[model samples]
Target: MTMEHGRAAGTTRKPKVVFVLGATATGKSKLAVAIAKRFDGEVVNADKIQVHAGAPVITNKVTEEDMAGVPHHLLGVLPADAEFTAEDFRRKAGRAVARVLAAGRLPVVAGGSNTYIEELVDRDNAAFRERYDALFVWTDAEPEVLDWYVALRVDDMVARGLVNEARAVFVPDDADYTRGVRRAIGLPEMHGYLLAEREGGAGEEELLALLARAVGEIKENTCRLARAQAGKIRRLSGLEGWDVRRVDVTPVFACMKDGGAACHQETWRKLVWEPCQEMVRSFLEAPGCRPCSSIRPARR
Candidate 1:
């Protein structure tokens, strides 16, 4: 079942699975969709928040109009209050990949959830037993640019009714914020604002102050998450060695909001997608090399 170079028992090789991973607000989802379109692939959601149902604005789910009919899976399927784990994701994602392969379409797994992506990379997982190569595309942005994007996104979320979304989903007694969609970024930070609103008697200025504080906390927390994500990637890279590819996307977001969709798409195609295509192409054409531990020299 293994594919060595271009030959697999003299049969044509299958497309490699592509994993697009990065911190939140790094444009990973956008790139995933575009790559899927270019490569005739389907995007499989790996973000924990995006997996839950009915919180598109809160979770920043890719919109239907924005999807461009590329077909995305595992988005908004789980109940917001339901509990799920990395093992659960592995099982579901395996089934999804199998289905995508059965339909002869490439599977592009994309999200900001590093743990979920790492689980898929684990060889013990069923997804890794299919005898197909996987290409890990790590999307990145400059720290300052990422900060700007996260702040802007938080502001936009507030303008688009994030407060109301928090109000609707907030549970007064639910202190276990680590469970289900509650674990989503930005919710716990809004606790103070929600509490102040429910307590009443606060002036408009005071309410605004509370919201501003919450917004700041959201940005800080997101940056912290990005740092932790980077640490995990570093550890994983050390273990996986040459399997990881990093792509800087700071410029893509720099002009994304200012009517630069077409321009951004072209830039991404040239910088990220094209390089990924070349890497995977090279891998498919090169003779497969076994690990050093698995090699046994012939006896003299």
Candidate 2:
């Protein structure tokens, strides 16, 4: 049956799902629990870390006492060393959502892992998927070697494309011997430079030295770009209708830590509990918000 947004047949409206996301040390769990209590919702774990088992103390898994009888799914269910991927989370989380709907309860996903949340929402479009894969390849390469290789490839590709006719023809010399043969056969110039640096031959040491300097320059440039982007984000965040706020919950967590619980209760309070509670409360108290008829108490 098609579900209408909090409306009976012939009533016009659509219900919206609620999502709460933030960085670590934000109180997501507490907020989710509180929201669940108020709205008769079931909380779903969206953070990747909270899925591991056997280390609630280390991972700050929610305790029964902390849950206060509210239902939380997908927490402390996996072994710590076991690998869990986004695809795994997506399948499991989708099932959890379906179950919540089947039970006529609100499904609230709360967590700090932005990537996990994005996957839960199925926002992985082709462009993002391609970019994600590219990033994985990029990060796996040695920084200095990768930078030099990338630079050379980009330059060569641009030259081949005839985007710039004035560019010098890339030649593989004895100094560029590392992967010069590969580069000569149409490998990216960047890869060739890296290969030469790594292989180190007669005068390859000089080439390697040049590559090191180039890498340093690249790092500095990258940092500058990041800072500039951050500044832009800050500026844009201050624009109209932006409700961005950064809260420091360190003191609250510190208190929980100093209070001397068996583990990092402060992390739980800050990362899970508080943030979840706030999000729940905000949605519940929003103007025109009403009790969702879809919400039903889960059978114990």
Candidate 3:
């Protein structure tokens, strides 16, 4: 079956991976299992914790029974003390994805580590630069105009009492000046700005507080968008009978805090099963080209 964004249509490539990420204690494994079962997908581990062989309990590796007939890869493959880097993960994950494609099954990567997902989706292309140019056409305008606009925005913020004028300095066309405004205004470059500031003698406490607020805002916005996107993807893909949902399962681990062999089944249901089910059902009902899972035909 073929799928297309606009005019172009071709075989629907199925490197379709769903990554589940959240903090420690999130029920990432259970969710991966449910998604795998529903979509005929396989789970690929992205958690650094679950990679260690001896610390199954400590790392919370998915058990055999929990797999529910779904295939899982990369779990318990590393020793606890061995260092694993993002580069290592990206290489291994790429291979796993290829293998999953060869086996005619979907590959689902799940974990709480954000670094894993970021690295997996990182694109080395000019698309980002093009996007930036398109969004800010006047970015290359006269330095005076750019400076005036920046100063205006900063001055407005100052009037609103959001910044301390005594510490803030405005320099025309300066990268630091632009970065500072971006941070003060709760923009995406805030993290980079904060890091730079910290290295440049910013007080730890003040920087931390600013970072906390920025992070909270980012999380709230991200969660809102994720919930909406998850729902939309489920609805659109379900009608076509192709499972395309991924979840972030972090709460499951939290429920295990007291420490015991007993599992937090409720957390699993709420954080993993429910979302997976929703997506699976939606995909099964949506209208679209089916994913190609044939082993007979090889890509040229």
- Which candidate tops lDDT? 1
lDDT of each: 0.74, 0.46, 0.46
TM match of model 3 to true structure: 0.45
By summed lDDT, the worst window of 10 consecutive residues in model 2 runs over 132-141
lDDT tens string, model 3, 199-261? 677677777676556545544543443344334333433332222323333344444433322
C-alpha lDDT of candidate 1 relative to the true structure: 0.74
Ten contiguous residues minimizing lDDT sum, candidate 1: 291-300
RMSD to the true structure for each prediction, in A, is 6.6, 17.2, 17.1
Rank by lDDT (best first): 1, 2, 3
Per-prediction TM-score, please? 0.84, 0.44, 0.45
lDDT of 1 at 93: 87
What TM-score would candidate 2 get against the native?
0.44
Top-TM-score structure, candidate number: 1
